[model samples]
Target: MLETLGRSLDSAIRKIRRLPQIDKDAINALIQDLQRALLSSDVKVELVFKMTENIKKEAMNTTLQKAKRKDFIIKLVHDELIKTLGGKKAPIRIKPGKKNIILLVGIQGSGKTTTIGKLSQFYKSKGYKVAAVTTDTYRPGAYEQLVQLTKQIGVKCYGNPKEKNAIKIGVQETKKAMNDGNELIIVDTAGRHKEEKELMKEMAVLEQKLKPNEVCLVIDGSIGQQAYNQAEVFAKTTSLGSIIVTKLDGTAKGGGALSACVAANIGIRFIGIGEKIDEFEEFEPTTFIGTILGIPDLEGLVQRVQEAEVMPDPETVKRMMRGKFTLEDLYQQLKSIKKVGKFKQILAMMGGGNIPDALKDDAEKNIEKWRVVLDSMTAEEKESPNLIKKSRKRRIAIGSGTDYAVINKMLDQFRQMKKMMKRFTQMRQKGKGGMPGMPGMGKGAEQFMKKMSKDFKF
Candidate 1:
């Protein structure tokens, strides 16, 4: 998400990792590089200086030998980042078995309404009876937009286009949601401009009247330095209980928004990675820093996999364990990958060191091509790939609009996969355990592969 800043920070880390010895000069150079990166990303100058100062003091005072310097520096930077982006974890507060009210507020076009949709879907998927209520009567299409989002996520939405009173609508909808047995009530208020006092007044009324359990300030992550000011205003006007930074994906200034929120003392509760309704995720600062520094976020990856429900069915798992893998199963695997995320994004979560960006891009394209080729093949050909002769290959190539060589390569890949599966099955059957040396892995090898496929999906 913060690709520019991530690259800059990673560059400095790589330099330190390559150094045989880290001295005063090396530490100073790293700090300077970090300063440039954070500044360029619009992180507040004061916070940047403070973080660097802390890192420098700690590094200079450390008596660790040169051999441990690299690890120490990484840990220092990671800890400093976590401290800057909320010292202690502030998890989303949702009271179970009670009507939890979440009031979302932000400036116009800050993704407040869309974030409500994401939050509704998030809570709903967690087994809560969630309902969305739109009090944005001033915005022409705000109510309709929320209605459409709630319908898509299979949640109930309450709004009145004819009513001009936002607080009145909010009060009515919340009461209705409570009476209807909804466990979560998400209220979407009208987006206000900083200069618009009338809209702010309406929001204040709802804050007092509703006494929401959570007053979330939604800030657009691309706003850069302005994010700080926006967050401050919201925090003051509504006593912002938490913050949700939206549109972080593909934003070069995401670093600014996150740092800004932290500087304003607003704990980030969630981050909207994309425009999709399901793109909203809980924010974890340590994991986020690790992600930026090229470390694999195993926890976040697992969460996404679970959200996508990409686990292999028992029947499919049984078939693979029996060494009956086929092109159809491979097609299903590809579909699961698509369900998770883009290949490059998956690679980033798996630690960027494992795959170059160029290869990731090519692999993404190849995956789509593979799906098309599989689609072009007949059901019988997919089940019995051995039956596809030269004629069938040419026909499939023409149907899929791919070169014959691509099809041949896919077949070769399938052959390698089948061979691997067969060997793994044989190893388990012979009771030799995983890889002939790795102990305690009779069938664990296959299970590990399945877990990897589920988590990485690439």
Candidate 2:
């Protein structure tokens, strides 16, 4: 959803690369690009103006010499962008050893009940005894759905579907959950519009009855410009202390929902990236912003890629055991990682464990380029990479919009991995080796060390 925004921002950097100097004209042009991208993504116009003005003012105030000005100016723009998105993450507190009730309230269709399940799982994974209780009597089968979700996550669910009195259900179920020794009790309230007086009042009453530790307003990410109004009304109606934005899977309005958190002076406690229970994430601003700026969160990136469960097949495993790793296996692994996300969705959230700092950026940015390069290779070239002589490299480079040097680098990386595998086999034979469980760490790391060593000649 933020692809357009990232690409637009990248365009500004590319423009800097093309400019002879970071002069006043260049700063104005960059600000215009920034403003256009933010506004087009439905950012509040006033915020855009404010952000661009700040960027321009800072750019003009920089004392860097002409030779070093571009990098500083670009970094200034990136920093300002991060600041626009709250500058930092403040996670919602759900302490252990206490019956911490979290009341989730949101307008209809905000995915509130589902988020309750996700939130429960999140805390459960952190060793908290989690339970889910739903008082969503407004939406038919809402309680049933919540029950199923809780069942899937192995958490106990409370609240009767036929119970129309939300406050009664909330009070009873919340107490029951506490008595049952649940440390984190996520109470799912019925979704209601701010204008729905009866439902709003019921939510307020339920909040008072349950006395939740946190009253989180779950806003649908696609609510766009209306997030502020919804948040404001709910804040007025109840003790709205936290926000969770949901359905951020593909909606362009995601940016608006996120920015609205800042516009309304609220910090987003969590964000739902997909319908899956594990898709929910704590809103960490630095990692989020780093991903946007094409900086790979190596640990996060690796974990996510590994979560895709891409592994070598038996045949490939045998080859790997024999120290015969090949490009074919690497290509399949990379394709699976790509299935997790686009090669470069910088603003989309960003990566892997223990990747060298030097290679993380190159790795994050080159997946797409490598895909093109690999796709341009012939079947024979893939099966026998060493066969790609200078003439073949020249041909492939032209076809892939890359250069011969990059192809050589890739070849070197492949051989390096192969050699590392051979070394592992030799070490095991000599009873002198044990691989670390973590990818890209310890002695085995040499296999992945230079996988994306430096910028490719793309």
Candidate 3:
């Protein structure tokens, strides 16, 4: 996301880190570079200038010496970026033991239907009994589309494809969801464009009749400067609790859409990173800016991992600790990584520094190839990778229709991975009263998340 802007900002920060001294000229040059990057990414000229002005004033006023000055400047820029993107708004959360209704509104092609599906899966994965109610009676197949999307993730959806009255469907479906024991109900409305008066009227009607716990505006990330107008128009019709920006994946206008939406006086609650249902995530401005500046967002990474349920289970952890790691386990690990996100995306969250594009692509391809090769192997061979000797490798390669070298590389990687896991196991065992066992993790995990959200250093 915002790859161009991120690369530009990362380069400037790395340059500062490498520089022996950051004089006045260096600071001015950095500001100029920031302006250029923001402009190139389609950020509103006014917001960019204001952010730079704040950064300049703070950096110039800092009394720190050379070493500390650089740190101060980086932090100043990070904080300013966050402030511009709506700093630290209260997170949108479901009230326990209460029925939560979220109404989503947006213009045509804004990805409202898909986002509702994603939100359903997102909340469902977190243990919420989620259901989606489709009030989009105008759009052809809108209800069916939502049903198909939500069905893949096992989210219940209620809609009347034949119903012309959207408010009726919304009211009835929502009541049905509440009666069905659903904790979270996400309502999808008809997409309204600038010239569509009737649909816009329908939106206000649905909002009034449904009385959603929260009304959310879904804006396309590539809408750029127009996002401001769209957000404002939607706000006038219905009070927005938050905004959800879609199609941010690799979009240059993502920056513009974000700043423009926030400028409309509404905080962004979530961002769509890609087309996948699981790619949508909560928007944290501090972590976002820190990521752009190459800061490691461990909390964000952990959240994704948790959402994906990628953590090793107790049985698997015990097996690894007992040196029972095998190709099957490695295959499962690769699958978990895929579920979490793309390799490059994961790298970004972990502060991946200057990795060559070729390597990133190759790594992604290798994972796909690894999965294929592992699939070709028998259950016995996967359990005992040692059983697959030279002859077995060639046979498996032919069976998978992949190069023999791929299998060789995979085996070598597995060996190195196993060794690393062994070392970590030893280190853990050696510690007196070491890291908490996986079994006792959930008791305080919620409290831990709360504390981290407040005190987490982005």
Candidate 4:
């Protein structure tokens, strides 16, 4: 999502690797490059300067006795940048109370209504009884938009277009939601310019009336520094507890939202990565820094993999490790992987690099092909792929509506992966094994197998 800035930062960090030392001159050059990149990405000038200055000071003062200069510089930059982007993580406060209220505020065209819908959907998925309340009496379509969105999300919405009193409407909706057993009520206010004192005052009244747990300022990422200014004005007028940057998909200049967080002295709790309700992501500084630096954080990926449910038992894992992995295990793995989301997203979450362009383009098609091939297999053949005779393979291929070559390719890939796992198990047994680029003893595979055994049943 931060692909542009990520590429720029990755390139800048790579330059450090070629430097002889982290002297002042080298550090200054790197800082200059970073400043230029941030400025170009629409980050506020003052924020960029502060960030670069911190980076420069840290890089120049870092000792290289225990670590490489490049590694130190990268770590320093990552930490400082995260600090500048609001060091502490912030989460929405949904305490055990009568009704937790989150009031969303933003200028017109900032996607406030859409964000409310998305938030409702997000909370609904988490098993919260959420309802959307629109107090936007200014715009004609505002109430309609919110109503349609809440209905689409299958959540209750409270609004009355004819009600001219925004504060009264909000109070009534809050009471109704509470009486209806709604745990969370997201109030969508009319979008107004931060400069509009009257509208800002109205927002304050609504806040006082609703006593919202969170007053989230929704800023448009594409507006860049302008959005920061808007956030600043809003913060000056209201208690802006959290920030939510929207329209982050594609080539949006989102860095300004980070700058806004610094300017407004608020942490970003959620970011809109796409139009879909499920596209919001909670901000994690380390992961965000890793993603921006284009260094896939294998640790994060390993955690996600650990969260996934793989089939079979300790005996099965041991058998697979011993080169006896069957199609049954492969089928189970496929089902688990499918639960994790799209292949590309799964890879990204695992700190895997960008899929090759050709592979990326064909990933969905490949997945479909695999699903078809798996579906066509007989129960006996799937349990023991080696039992599939050539004639059975032809019949299965015909049944799946895919060519025999595609079937053969799937089998070949499965065999290759199984062989590699077998070799890894042997290496572990001989005290000479580990996954390539994996840290420590090649024990992660064994640990992963053991963990899977506990979590999954055959």
Model 4, C-alpha of 245: deviation from truth (Å)? 1.4
User: Per-residue lDDT tens digits of candidate 1, residues 1-458?
Assistant: 78898999988888987898888999999999999988988888998999999999988876443545567776788778878788544656778889789999987898988998899888888888999999987778988999988889899998888888888899988999899998889999888644578877888899999988889999999998788898877776777888899988868888889988888887888999999988878898877888887757545534543433333465666676688989877655545554453322222222321233443344455877888899999888998899989999999999999998878867876675577557756865775535643233445555555554454452
User: Across residues 64-109, which tens digit of lDDT does each residue of candidate 2 receive?
Assistant: 4465576666666666776877855455676779768888998778
Q: Which should have the higher lDDT, number 1 or number 3?
A: 1
In order of listing, the candidates' clash counts read 0, 10, 0, 2
lDDT (C-alpha, whole model) for all candidates = 0.77, 0.72, 0.76, 0.73
Considering summed lDDT, which 10 consecutive residues are worst modelled in model 4?
341-350
Question: Local error of candidate 4 at 289, Å?
Answer: 1.7
Please give, for residues 345-414, the per-residue lDDT of candidate 3 as tens digits. Answer: 2222223322234533444668888888988999998887888998998889999999988888778767
Candidate 4 structure quality by residue, lDDT tens digits, 324-351: 7766565454444544433333233223
Once fitted onto the true fold, the runs of candidate 2 whose alpha carbons sit more than 4 angstroms away are 18-20, 193-195, 297-458
Q: How close is candidate 1 to the true structure, as a TM-score?
A: 0.63
Candidate 3 at residue 105, lDDT?
A: 94
Regions of candidate 3 where Cα sits further than 4 Å from its true position:
193-195, 297-458
When summed lDDT is taken over every stretch of 10 residues in candidate 3, the lowest stretch is 345-354
**Which is the winner by lDDT between candidate 2 and candidate 4?**
4
- The CA-based lDDT of model 4 is what? 0.73
